[model samples]
Target: MASTPVDHSAPDTAARSKVERFRANPWLALTAVSFGLLMVQLDGSVVAIANPAIGRDLGASTAELQWVTNSYLIALAASMILGGKLGDRFGRRLYYLVGIGGFVVTSVAIGLVGSIEGVIGFRALQGLAGGILMPNTLGILRAVFPPKRFALAVGIWGMVSAVSTSLGPIIGGLLVEHVDWESVFYLNVPIGLVALVFSAVVLAESKNSGGRQRFDLLGVVLLAAGLVALVFGIVKGETWGWASAGTLGSLALGLALLVVFGLYETRQEHPLLPMRLFRNRSLTTGAVMTLLNFFVMLGGIFFIMLYLQNVRGYTPVEAGVSTLPMSIASLFASPLGSQLTSRLGARVTIPLGLLLSGAGMFGMLSWSVDSSYATMWPPFVAIGLGVGIVLPATAATIIGNAPVRDGGVASGLQSTMLQIGGALGTSVLITVIAGKVGSSLFGELTGAGVPAGVARGLEKAEDAVTMGIAPVSGDMPAQLRAAVVEGSGQAFVNGLHAAVTVTGVLCVLGAAAAAVFVKGRAEEARDMRAQAEAAGEPVGVVAAH
Candidate 1:
């Protein structure tokens, strides 16, 4: 059952009879949905860039710094399924508008927050709103365009997303340089407002049009707590030994809750996640690939932002602009990559794309105190092209295999994976990087010209450089500062090297997963049409050539 081209028929009496069918106005609906939902895509991409500025402005400690990114991502992961179910039960457009409005308002709040606590709280609300918006975008797209044009519309949506991804750093950088970190949040206000106003005018509401459905409140709480605890453990594990009580406790509790979640989901009628979805090899593998790709993509980006600012001594603007070449390059590669997906097929394209990302990540290992833009550009280009190639095709796989009845849930699961993987990636990499920093104590002592005798004394596991603050230990004066600088710089370099290596490996695994497991596009579409026909749902006229 291969997917044929869309049966573009004239507005026949039969074609025009159905409310759901994509008729002469289908593209109109598609465009409106794309524009209306643009804010979520934009926020996911741009918001991370403001982290450094926010930290400085609010005088955040190390632990609280991680919250700047994770708070939004963690809440988004927890609530996405619930949002999708709500969209299915109620009108998607209603939830969509509410979610978009919430995002706009919260972005402004994040901009205005004077304390780290305020930022974290608003970020959680923003994440919840973003969760509601993401699944709705795909659902609305399906409701608008005929099945035939769905891929193209989705492709464009992905392109905008890539654009948004690239936007975060650049926009955040610019605003931070010219105005303040608050401006980055402020920019979203207008863009979101514009999208919100237009959507109210042009978008149509669509839903399951069925009976009431149960909301999984317990599952939501359990899952949110589990992820927060798990991520908190990962981000802090380097500081608190993995064997320490706090680290062990969070891990045990998080895993236990997730286990309970799996058991509860199966027994519930109309479960938030139907176990049957996992039965499809394509869905399982596609979701895994999606998770893996997003993991490396986000991890690498977050790490680079830190590297650029902390180690490279770049301003926020410089760090933002540094990524511009990659972003701009992706703008062109993204569309071209979509065309390649149909031609080469997923097997060829997915692997090739990941291989490119791996190569790019490996290229980043060349970064050092002596390095310049030259060392960074090649890898950035590789990642941009690779990411652009994988995104659209991966999306098609996710949507292609999902049943129309469970569209919102399926889409929500996919969105959850994207956000969760990203959150987890940041958490994991932060720990790894911190470990690299802590272990660099010896190198810093040696590089700073500490006497072999003195350096030997510095070997205890505590912050040895700061430990040098002892009166007897402070005699070296200039040597102590030099050692600290060398150590800190090398620590950053070491962490970047380790992080990129991890990202490259994950990208390879993701590529392999996509190649081996994802379904053929045509087979999925055939299954969808067959299921629709069997359910006594209107299948619409499969347009005559």
Candidate 2:
């Protein structure tokens, strides 16, 4: 029997065909990348709406509930830069597939967990997967798209990220109200599966061929330890007493470790984060701006969700629905802000956005037990518009300022700042609110005609409010129920006001920093053009306007 002659060129032909198909349909590539990014963004806030339900079902304490969220954030923040570095060294498509697979498995485990501890553990794993998944989205996009089309692709990427993040609470709320709390985690499973399949089929493998590849295991450990210590200190400050040894020691240790990490990075030939990037004033300013932005944004979301569900007695779906104005405004404002950045420059536009955010936080101070949706929606809109405008400008500033060779590092830094800021904001704000609520609850309740004994009892149970669990109306004595609800509502409002005021002050500081440090349009354009010329890439019109 004779064998047919082997077609030696078949593999090469198939490869060419695949490449041509991808080039012909860039939108299809975008769709696959966006699906993975959407899943990551969605997870960021979806669990927020389900927090109350998770607490009730697991009988978790306020601290435990916080850990559920913080664990994920800390893991994500700590590993993000490393993830980006790994993607650059290895194949992005391979890492992305592993990330999606791990994310799906973790999501399933989280949904099936019987205890809060299990949920927290699984959530951290999910975030680790997210850290791996997210950085590659931009990397893959950059690899596939031409430089001329990069800005447009990034714009669409930013839009998808913003929309998915905004939709999290709404989707989680609907699931929690109609299906189950577990449904929120389970929801990611299907999304991940679809993303994995599409990515495997459409995504091409890409890696940086220029530098020597090395993993900074020591840096990763130090960074993770520092963050955990810092966040732990903040989260536990109320219980440990802010001046106590536990709180002071943890904070001091965290700061010292970070300082060490910075010093170590400076010495390393191939550092996890190249310290030289911070030499760019605009990048530093943009990083600081993003940090503050998420600090206010995430912290505000945590408290507002509690107020709507626990204080105002709205259902999860209703609470989510009430926040629609902010999301809608953000959808419009992000694209508009991109245009404004081109005309006004990040110096003016970034500060303007921060100012709006500060104003929105100030407006939130007027919220009380008696405030209505009309009053609430205005602040929501202000915040949405501010965040919508600020995020893209800040991201552009960071990425734009970097040498083209260091783009991945610049992007990873931005994401790391975002997650860390969110974690810190949630921790610090929750601590402030908890401390205020605990100190004032008894006095306020007694002043409202609650008996001293009953006031003491209610004070003991104040965690219900701070942890996002509503007191069961049926369980309370009819006379005390009304007073208790009113008193607790006032206390929560007071705490919320204090937190918002603090956030407003930070926003003002961020705005001032942006004004001082971010460059004007002409200077930034010149710098970008120089970078492009140095790299031997054509200076696209997108670099100008």
Candidate 3:
């Protein structure tokens, strides 16, 4: 008797109100998207700090520890393009929701796993989920924000990424020191839940809305297999001996598969990656720059953390705290880089950033067994500023210059470069360190008065350091302990210097590539207009900052 007529306009009115609120304060939307991105970035770095503790608890060998990290990276790299395509074809919001849920579940599973193999498997699953979430973060931002404000939004996004990744070690260190290694993985559970709820509530649905999309199953398989083989060969080369049939065959097979994949994509009607995208020099250059940037930065960080803990006898917490200067510097430098890009363009900023990073890597050559944090922080700050500037600018360049229909693909490609570069960097640097240590450890130990028999027996010290274990374990003769400690420390420093030198050289080459290949803002705008016109879309600039 008390029932009234239904208000049919209520749903539409609520939807309109939400859209208006989003328009009024896009920053709120940015906050919502950035949370998921922050979680993904945090997980990438936090696990690095926990790797040693994980090995200790699970009794994982050096190769298994390397697999723990590489498996996640390789899986993410392999699936990222597919994830981006899925988001484009379906909806970004839906994929993002699934990604967050999967990531949370896997994180919990990893924490609960008892064996190293289980942890590695679950970590790979976590990476697959992350691959799905990451590209959508930028796609949604591009969808919501206009080009005028997009540069600043990207800067803010980069800042959140830099800060979260930078602080991951500190957070992980505290968790591992005070709680346990499992606590590091469990930390993601609450953060992920909060991000998932916020994303569902605050984010709007967006998709390509273009012609019908197609999946390339063969492309996916080839890429995944090729990358797995490549990374495996690089990671295991030291143990397998560079000249061994196993290592050489893996490398050759991976290269052949990749070559075939590239050729096949060129002929496909709807390729996973459009071969024509490479014609856009800015996009190509940006992708390469991102790859080189993370290669040097992440690889260096991996060894530095080990050096701090295993060589210098610092605890995980102490090692993490000592690197705060770099993180703090990056916090400020990111915004400054955004401002610089708005004025100077990526062509200039990117090269300058590379040069600065190269200088920082060269500075690391001065490191020694006796060097203190005081000597290290200056180089840290330099590197932080360099990465802070380079990463955001290149990200903006690639995404801004991309066509609207291809935003998700561009984002995924950028992410793919980053993960692949990081994986390769870690593998190559670890290999370099192992080679250097293998050659030098025996001589150093013998020179330090370690008997020839003991020196040969302690040859495993190279593996120990690579795995983040101290050279001298358990009680030993005082003289022998001293010899072993000194020898190990010196050998590690030598390897670190060699790795840093290679990084420095690569950074210089990256600068050259950026200068030559990245176009200016005016040219980039014209190119975007050309692309939009060719696609029969709006004839104005699609993504000019």
Give the lDDT of residue 186 in candidate 2. 89
Candidate order by decreasing TM-score = 3, 2, 1
Q: Please, what is the whole-model Cα lDDT of each candidate in the order they appear?
A: 0.70, 0.78, 0.81
Which has the better TM-score: candidate 2, or candidate 3?
A: 3
Per-residue accuracy of model 3 over 1-545 as CA lDDT, tens digit each: 79888987989999988875664355766888788888899988889888889999999998899888878887788778778777766787788888889999999999898999999999999989998988877767766676667777887888888788878988988888789989888888888999988888777777765667577888878877887787677656767877899999988988899888889999898787677788888988999998888887788788888788888888777877888887887888787887788888889889888888888889989999879777899989888888888888888887777766667778888888888777777778888888788788888888878899988888976787554454786688998888888877888888888888888899889989898889988898788778878877642122221
For model 1, state the Cα shift of residue 470 in Å: 20
Give per-residue CA lDDT, model 1, range 141-173, as digits (tens): 655655555566666767777777777776666
**lDDT, model 1:** 0.70
Better structure of 1 and 3 per TM-score: 3
> Candidate 2 on 9-70: residue-level lDDT in tens?
98999998887577435567678888888888898788987887999999999889988987
Model 2: pairs clashing at backbone N, Cα or C within 3 Å: none
Candidate 3 regions with alpha-carbon error over 4 angstroms:
1-25, 56-62, 241-243, 446-460, 465-470, 473-476, 538-545
Alpha carbon deviation, residue 193, candidate 3 (Å): 1.2
Stretches of candidate 2 exceeding 4 Å from the true structure: 1-28, 55-64, 113-116, 142-155, 238-241, 438-443, 451-462, 465-477, 530-545
